[model samples]
Target: MPTIKEIAEATGRGKSTVMRAVKELGLRESGHANPDGARGALIIDAEGASMLADFLTKNVEAKQAAGEGETESSNQPHIDVEAIVSVYRERIDDLKAQIDNLNAQLAIKDNQIKELTCALDNAQDAAKEAQTETRRAHDQVVLMASAGVWERLTGFKGLLGPGSDMDSQ
Candidate 1:
């Protein structure tokens, strides 16, 4: 983290100027007591420092370009091709990295979906097997009852026998 004073010194500007720029840029800052106990200093991170540097560079370049154009009596503004190319290259690289990250995340989600689909298929197979087993057990119970197995096992001559009231009716 760099303090406001350090940023001002590095940019060769006043503290108030740096402070105003920082505030206008919406840079993040934290307050900490200075070494000399002069209240608190606003500390900015590397990102904020870089932003300030870029701002100062652009401001200086604009002023210089304006002065040059005015002195030369030329209507065309000065264009720095190299600086523009460098900035574009940085942006392209940043976008490519983001694309790679998104692709990786998409692949992970696709794998998860495949695994879930397989699990659902297995669960469906298991449910079909359970239903078949239940049907088979029901058939076995019906056969046993028709063959008088219940009477042999429990020794109870029920009405479902050969000469029962149901047969007469």
Candidate 2:
């Protein structure tokens, strides 16, 4: 509990206003005696103080609605909305540019992938051709081995058969 004077000091209102609020709101005063067996002074509790605060806030808002609550802050300056919007637009443009750059990089990587795939296909075709040539060379070696041992021992030619290279020449 606090006296109306103390409440006025804490709430930044006059003591007369506090008393008027107590009267208007029908707030209760302290009734309990002190431990020294003395009666307490006229005071309102936290609940009554809270009611007074609400009552004051409503009155101020009502006055403001009636065009009478103009304060120093409201008289100062308005916010720069165009400047803020311009800053946001610049940020959006920067983000769009970054997205364009990333898209270009993605396209380059996609081209590289396509080129690598084409190179791999060409390498595989060359490897298959090399394998075919190696197989043909192996068959020639086998045919030469199958020529008669006598022809090899005597250093003779044209003795393998009609299909031999010497006969063809």
Candidate 3:
């Protein structure tokens, strides 16, 4: 991370210009947010610093090409290419870390979905078994109701079919 003043100095632009570019790019704050001229410095994230440097490079280059009061020593715009590249690298690393975190969360959610689906299938199987048992019980009731009182009172012998006489035994 770099400060706005550092970027402005490296890019040969005013601090106000760098601050405006920061606002325009819609950069979120990861550093101190004291804008009322507080003692703390407004540090910029790597992404914002890289973008700010790029923006300043183009704007300042255009102005310099117009020959705006430049001696032989001041002909070229002062830009720290190495620093800008470093900022870009930092931003890329940050993005990679975020992707890894999101992938882990996605994996967890996928596991949860698999567990829920298995539970539902098991519940469906249990309900089918209960239905089969209920049907068998209903069939037994129908058979008992159709038989005469004496036959039904015979219990197992009645279930063995009609015309069962056990009186001799």
Candidate 4:
């Protein structure tokens, strides 16, 4: 049993508001009038008061949870879209830079390949000239041997005219 003034002060509500709420609660048949019927105070049993307090606490908690859930759901799509766009932009920039680098490397490799091909052609020409010079020198060596200015190590010689030993053989 508490006075209206005590309930109002404890709950931070006005006395009239407390009295109204008490009357509303009386609909549950939980409140009672005083024995003498003089300025009757709201009387609630201990179990009934506990039940009412529990119900009020649960109701407030439910409302708060519902509000938080609505806010989170509303913002979820916006957050996901922003994150996806940001990652896509970053990847596109990275790929563009990589392509630019590859183009530069390709140009360098093309120039190097051209240079190597030209050098290889020049080397082949030089080798052909060297082989011609070597064959001319060998012909001179054989002429010197036939003229008796040089001696053949194997003593095998062939004449270079119509009477050549190779022709007869």
Tens-place lDDT digits, model 3, residues 1-169: 5777877777766788788887776664543223434766777766677777777777767876876676547545577777677777888999999999999999999999999999999999999999999998889778767878877566646464466454322
The TM-score obtained by model 3 is 0.68
Model 2 per-residue lDDT tens digits across residues 34-113: 12215545555444555665665566556556765655355422323343344345456766988999999999999999
**TM values, all candidates:** 0.45, 0.44, 0.68, 0.42
Clashing pairs in 3: none
Over 4 Å off, model 4: 1-78, 148-169
User: Model 1: residues >4 Å from true position, as ranges?
Assistant: 1-19, 29-85, 142-169
Prediction 1 TM-score vs. true: 0.45
Indicate which candidate wins on TM-score.
Answer: 3
Predictions ranked by lDDT, top down?
3, 1, 2, 4
Question: How many Å off is the CA of 27 in candidate 1?
Answer: 3.0
Please tell me which predicted candidate would have the highest lDDT against the true structure.
3
Per-residue lDDT tens digits for candidate 4, residues 1-169, read 4455543444344667555665566624544322224766554433333333333344446655778846544322112233233334545676688899999999999999999999999999999999999998888677756665333432334434466564464
RMSD of each: 9.7, 21.3, 5.5, 28.8
Better of 2 and 4 by lDDT: 2
Query: TM-score rank, highest first?
Result: 3, 1, 2, 4
C-alpha lDDT values of all predictions: 0.66, 0.62, 0.74, 0.54
- Residue 93 miss distance in model 3 (angstroms): 0.4
